[model samples]
Target: MFFADGLNCSNFDRAVFQELVDGGLGCVTVCLGFWEDAVASMDALGRFRDLVRANKDLVAIARTGAEIEAIAGSGRCALVIGYQNTAVLNGNIRFPELFADMGLRVLQLTYNNQNEFGGSCYEPQDSGISRFGREMIPELNRCGILIDLSHVGERTSLDVVELSEHPVAITHANPATLVPHLRNKSDTLIRALAARRGVIGLATYANICGEYGASPSKWADMVAWTVDLAGIGHVAIGTDHGRNVGMPDLTWMRQGNWSRIINYGAGNAARPGKVAEPGWIDTMKSFGAIATALAARGFSQDETALLMGGNWLRLYTEVFGETDAQKQLAA
Candidate 1:
């Protein structure tokens, strides 16, 4: 059975590559930078590209759904490059096509803090998408880059959902109804997302999953609930579990030269080096256990398979199938 993880921010090293290969994960949306500026973002992505090139046998950069499907069961995992924030774009309306051409298929409109795009979930005032952001949407759609609204403010997220011509995604967020975290989505948003035929990859981050965190059963049940709430084809796994393997770097992830005051996000003042995840669903390899849990939760085999990876594959194909000519013309 082919499994897909919505996101993996692990080190681009042989060990992590081997783990994905061993885990039987077909694809992962990789983080190039959390909050990098334009030139720095390009440089970081260049380095990641080098890593992929260096380990061609273990992973291949997948630009289209066909590429991801072709690489399935080929003893290697496909890397779907993405950005966690739009700071890298530096408010440039033209760069969406440029980055899309570079094979970065996913771009988040905002991170935990506001930029030119609009407000963040962490902001006091949730301003909706800015005028510049409104302008960028058409270009992003024209470029066939999938829009991710994971860390965006509630209003901005809704604005994007209404404005985007193509379906958008919340690639690594959970339902706030369950966890009540700032980063999680509301029931209204989830229902709207599904109505648009978009996908939401439920995140397995400790805080977002809940205080007790995610065991295989807990994880499965959360997914089952989301499936019931959003429909089966709209729920998938995006275990935001990358900080587990290496030295934790909240400073870079949270501050990132954006603020003078330390923003220890998620209200953890201690800023623990590593946030613990439940053992059963902690790593990439454990993703398949979700399938078992889904089946046990009374999901049919077909529904379980769709939740595992088929839904992600379907979304990927719909958004990335556009040809260069089509994108250019759409521009």
Candidate 2:
């Protein structure tokens, strides 16, 4: 089965990643940086590119679904470079094109706080997609970059669904109905996203998953519930796996220097807490357990395949269409 993680923040461990691919991972979207300015974003992109190049034998930068399929066929993993915020664009409309040229594909409009584009879920008030955000949508569409609303405010997420010409994704989130967390999504928003043929990725973060450390059964139940709500085709896997490296840990994701106080994402507002990786599917190698879990829940092989990766492949193929720059870069 081809597995695509919605978010992968794991510390670079080539041997471990290779082992995971050998076990059963196809593609993973790794964030370059969020809350970064243009220059820093480019720098991060360069480093990521270098990492891919260094491990070219085991992985390749996947800019298209065909490439992903081909790479998986070769028993290697495909890396899709994604960004968690548009701060890299720096309000410059031209940056999306530049990022696309640099092999950046998925881009979340905002993180957990307000930016030039819109409000974040953490904000007391959601301003929704701003004028500049409205302008960026078309350009992002044209550049063949997939729009993600994983960390956006509720209103902003809805606004994106209404405004985007192409289907947008909440690439890594759980249903709030089950967990009742801010990071999780409501049924209305999930349905709205599905109506436009957009996909919703089931998040693996414990807080969003409604437990400090969830079991495979719990995750499977959530996936089944999501499929029931959004249709089988609209559900996919986006494990928000964080890099376990203490040297460069998740401090950037939570704090980002956006706030003097630690902004514990998915954790409660009172204090920060670490998201202990679930025992069953902690690493990418264990991703196949999800398929087994689905099977146990009476999901057919086709349905299991869809949840594993086919749905994501369909969404990416459609959203990240063949633009001139993409074609040229491929050549």
Candidate 3:
């Protein structure tokens, strides 16, 4: 369901994703690109599109809660297209809508370094949204594209939260109450984002979770921090699990400015003590158990459901909900 690299729906191993879905992963915000070119990303999406057409019985793209609801009820998981970087847009405004049409519902503006849109969390400047980012906001708004600031710079995250006409999303991030990782959104930033009524997906990427993001509870600690700071409504589970392998897009970032010394996608393999550590979910743990733990963390059932998936669905309906054009398009 997390449309990872290589094994896009084209080379999709349904068995892997299906286990998650069958185990109750209602909707999966799948990744499509990290540092790919416009053509390559589009080619990747097109392949997914073809797969959707070929496998309508199992998977379907959903832009609305109704579709997601249908997918979940049918005992299949909903696929929400996502991108980890804007590089695939290739510095063009139109790509937001074009990719939106291709079903790219969620997008993180930058991966690790500066791009035309904004400074990366790893970039020296970290000033905020660039001219290209300013350009990207309105059009992404117009196209009903949900903005994700997960891997973007702190300043840029604040700016987009303020600049966007609709709520934005930090699809996968740690709350960052402690030291900042290139991908963790700080409490201040998370609160600022929460003020805009956005959705913040708690990721299971080991590097970002502390214990080098390798421990599931390290992930839980981040979520607990977000819950402490942003509250359950602003917190949600989002294991940034890619696939059998991490995306080459991350490899592509190394050619630019990778701060961490190891592979971002390795999860916990490279981290020395993580595997030996107790209860490090690595996000590979049964997602349902993750949900149960979140509930036990004092998250009320309503808020628990929201953080689990409802908030994301509501945020989607709010932004991509019923624009006059989208209404017509849906019609």
TM-score of each candidate structure, all chains considered together: 0.94, 0.94, 0.83
**lDDT tens digits, residues 31-98, model 3?**
77667789989888888778766766666778766677777787766778877788888887777877
Error of 3 at 290 (Å): 1.2
lDDT of 3 at 249: 44
Candidate 1 per-residue lDDT, tens place, 166-254, comes to 88999988989888889999999999888888999988777677842546777777887888899988998888777345334666887
Clashes of 3: 7
Lowest summed lDDT window (length 10), candidate 3: 1-10
- Please provide, for model 2 over 62-101, each residue's C-alpha lDDT reduced to its tens digit, 9 standing for 90 to 100: 8888888888888888888898998888889998998898
Q: Residue 321: error of model 1 in Å?
A: 1.9
* Whole-model lDDT per candidate: 0.83, 0.84, 0.67
Error of 3 at 170 (Å): 1.1
Model 2 bad stretches (over 4 Å): 211-213, 269-271, 323-331
Q: Where is the poorest 10-residue window by lDDT in model 2? A: 242-251
Candidate 1: pairs in clash? none
C-alpha positional error of residue 290 in candidate 2 after TM-score superposition, expressed in Å: 0.3
